[model samples]
Target: MENNKGKSEWVSQQNYSESQSTPYCITRRYGSLTFEETVQNVKNGIKKLGLDLVGEFDVREYLSSDMEKMPRHLILMVCEKETALKLISNDIQMSVLFPCNVTIKEVENNTIIEVSIEDTDSTWSSAKKKEIIEVAKNTKNILKKLLDTIEQQNVKL
Candidate 1:
C-alpha cells in the first residue's frame, strides 16, 4: 500500500488477489499505473530479478478487425535460469511450464494495471515433491518481489 516514497499512493484502487486452477496457476496484483508504464516496469523487473526475457507477445497485435480495439494485453515470458535447470532436472515433463508468464493488461478502460504471474505452486502441490517445492517457492517469492518493484516505481497523477 506504500508508494515509491513510502507513502500511500493508490491503495484505494489497488486490489491484491490470487487465483488458481487445477494444473495452471495465476498470481495477480493490481495497480494504478498506466498500461504502458506497467509494461515497461514489468520488463525492467524481469531483468532486475535475474530472469531471462525469452520474449514478449503482444496480444493486441493479433487483432486485424474490430478486435484491434480491445484492451491492451501483453505477455512476457521470463525464465529463471536456476529455476528452469532445477525443474527439468527433477522431471523433463516440467518443461511444458517453462518460462513463467507475466501478463500486463489494462482493465476498466485503462484505469487499472493488472499484472498476472504464473505461479508454479500447483505443479508441486499435488506431487508434494520437496525439491520442486523449494524451487517453486523461491520462484514465487521472486515474482512477488517483481510485483512490489513495479509498485514502488511510481508516478504522480
Candidate 2:
C-alpha cells in the first residue's frame, strides 16, 4: 500500500511474517519532538478531533517502582462515544476492544506512536463486518489526522 508522507501506517496481521501474529496497529514516528511534547501534542489533537481522553498511563513511571529502567513511554486511551456505541450495538463481543489504545514510546532519537485497531475477523454477517471495517477505518483516519496535525505543528515551532 502507498503511504502518505508523515502519516501513520496501518499494520495488519497480514503484513507480518509467518512467525509473528500480532494484531493491527497504526504506528507513526515523530522526529522533532521530545516525549513530553509529543504526548502533549497528541492530547491536544485528540481534543481537537472531539475524542475523549479516557486516561494516560506513564509506563516508565509505573515501572520505576521496580527499579526497571526504560525510555519514556505512555499509553493513551481515547474514544468517541457515538462510534463506540454503534460498534458495540453491532457486536457485543467488541467490548473487549473498546476505548482505543495509543502508545507513545521514545526510540533512539525519535518517539514512536502506536495505535491499535480492532480486529475485524469474526463469524459475523457481511453487513456487520462492513460496519466493523467502517468504524475501524474511520478511527484509523482520525488517528492519522492527529499525527499529521502534530507533525505540522512541530514543523512550524
Candidate 3:
C-alpha cells in the first residue's frame, strides 16, 4: 500500500484457509519514530487503555548476545483482565492464546508494529467461538488505535 507521501506503506493482511492454521499477523510502519520511542508509546497506550502488560521480550538483545545478526525487536504481551476472564470462562483451552502479542521492530529506517490477530477459527463450540471472536476483535481494535495514535503524534513532530 502507498501512503500519502507515495512511500510503500508497511501494512500486511493475510487470508488463511480452513486447512491452514496460521493466524493473521498485521504489521504497520511508523516512519517518524525510533525503535525506543515506538516501544515507549506502545506501553503508554496499553496503560491508557486499561490493559495489563504481561511482559516484554527483547528478542534482538537475546539473539545478539549469542552473536547473531538481527534488527532491534521487542515483543509485548498485553491483555484486558475482564476480556481474558470471559474467554477463559467460555473455554479453558483458550488460555493458550491468552495475553495478545504486540511487536516493535526496526525495519530499514522505520519502526514497525506487529500484532497477531487472534484465531477464532478453532474447533470449539459455537458459544466459545463467539466469545473468542469478540475478545479478539476488541484486542485488534486496541492495538490498531495505539498504532494510529503513534503515527499521528509522530507526523506532528
Candidate 4:
C-alpha cells in the first residue's frame, strides 16, 4: 500500500564529481521468483549473516502484482555502510548474484538488500548502471577486508 520508490538516498554526500555512475535495475523490468526454495535461500543468507532480516511476502506480492511479477526475496536490513560493503564482498565468486535478483542500494541511511528469486527486465541509465556496478565491486572489496580483519581478531581472541 505504501510507495517505496526513491528510498535509496544516502545521508552523507559521496564524492561523485568524477565518479562513474550507472543506473541500477537495468536488465529485467518484470519477472517472477515463483520458486519457494529460492526465496528460502535468500532468507537463509540474510539470517546467516546475523542481519535482522524479515520476510515481506505482502510487499513482494504487491510489487509483483503491480510489476506483474515477484522476486524470490525482499530482505531488509539496517546496517552501517561499512557493514554493507563487507557483506557484498564476502564471497569471491559472488555466485549469489547470478539469479539477477539482488538489488543493493542505499535507502535513506539504510542499505536495502533486494533479493529476487526471478529475474527483472528493467532498464537504467548507463552512467547510473556503471555506478551500481562500481558500488558492487567496492562492496566486495570492503567485505573481504572486513572478513579478514574479523578472522585475525578472532585468532587473537
Candidate 5:
C-alpha cells in the first residue's frame, strides 16, 4: 500500500488513542446476508434507515490492512445515536447473525479514531441462518429503540 498515512488527504487517518466503537449506523434489522453481499447491503441499509455513511470497504480493500490476515469484512457507517444518548445500555444484547467477517470502527472528520471487533466470523448453517435472521431482527429493534430514546432525550434536553 502506498504511504496512505498522510498522502491522500481524502482518506481519513486512523487514530489509535480512543476505544473502538460499534458500527451503530447500519442496523441489521432487515437481516444479515453472506459476507459477499454485506458491504452492498449495508450501504443500501444505511440509506434506507436514514443513517449517515461515514466510510465503507469491500473485502478486497480491507485485506490490504497491515494485519497478517483480514478476518471478516463488515461495512462500516457513522451513527448519530451516541451523539444523542450518553451511552448504550449494557443490558442490550448483541449477537452475530451470519457467519462472515465483520468489524466496526469509529471515525471523526474522516479519520478513523477507534476500531472494534476486528475479524469476527459468524458461521451460517441452516439453523444458524434462522438464528441470524432473528438476531438481525433484534438488532433492528434495538437500534430503533435506541434512536427513539436519543430523540426523547434530546427533546427533554
Candidate 6:
C-alpha cells in the first residue's frame, strides 16, 4: 500500500496491537483516497462484494460535540446472511460477533486514509465445531477480498 508519495506505508497485516478486549482480528491497508473518498469506497466495495452493509457510524462527528476538530473516522457494519446463519447454527454463542466491521480512518493529521477490516477468524477461536471454523474461515476470506477491492479502487492518484 503506497501513500501519495509513492512510499510504501503498509506497516502490518496482522493484529499486532491486539489486547484481550480487542481480540477481533484486524488488518489495515493504506490507499490513495482521502477520508471522504475512502469512506464511500468502503460502502461501494462492500456492496460490490455482495456483503450486507447493515450499519454505519461517523465516529468523528459523534465525538466532535465534546472535542475539537477531529480527523474523519467511520465504521461500516457488514455481514452475510448465509454466513451469519452458518456461524450461529454451529454455535449460538457466536451471535455476539455478528455483523463484522469495516473501519475507514483518517490519520497523519488527516492527510492519509487507512481502511481496516475486522475479520471473523480468531475472534471466536474457542469454537470446537467444524462448521463454526469453516464459517469463520469463509467470512475472513470474504472480508479480505473486500479490503483488496477497497485498496485497488483508486489505483492512480
**Top of the candidates by lDDT:** 6
> What does the lDDT come to for candidate 2?
0.64
Q: Rank the candidates by TM-score, best first.
A: 6, 1, 2, 3, 5, 4
Would you estimate the TM-scores of all the predictions? 0.75, 0.71, 0.70, 0.28, 0.30, 0.77
Candidate 1 overall Cα lDDT vs. reference? 0.72
- RMSD in Å for all candidates: 10.9, 10.2, 10.0, 16.2, 15.3, 9.3
- Regions more than 4 Å wrong, model 5: 1-32, 57-65, 80-157
Worst 10 residues of 2 by lDDT: 11-20
Residue range 1-157, candidate 5, lDDT tens digits: 4654422322334442323334423222111233334344444544565555665555436544543333344445444344213112221222222112224333343223122322112221223344444544444553444323322222333
Clashing pairs in 6: none
Model 3 Cα lDDT, one tens digit per residue, 15-93: 2122123445555665567777777778887888788899988876765534333666788888788887888888887
Sequence-dependent TM-score of model 5: 0.30
lDDT string for model 4 (95-140, tens) is: 3333223332222222222222211112211223454455455444
In order, candidate lDDTs are: 0.72, 0.64, 0.62, 0.34, 0.35, 0.72
Clashes of each: 0, 0, 0, 24, 4, 0
The superposed Cα distance between candidate 3 and the true structure at residue 1, in angstroms, equals 36
Per-residue lDDT of model 1, residues 7-28, tens digit only:
2333234333333232455545
lDDT of 4 at 106: 23
Off by over 4 Å in 4: 1-22, 25-34, 54-57, 63-157
RMSD over all Cα atoms, model 5? 15.3
> Where does candidate 5 have its weakest 10-residue lDDT segment?
117-126
- Which pairs clash (backbone N, Cα, C closer than 3 Å) in model 5? 72-101, 73-101, 99-122, 99-123
Query: Candidate 4: lDDT of 151?
Result: 20
State which candidate has the highest TM-score: 6
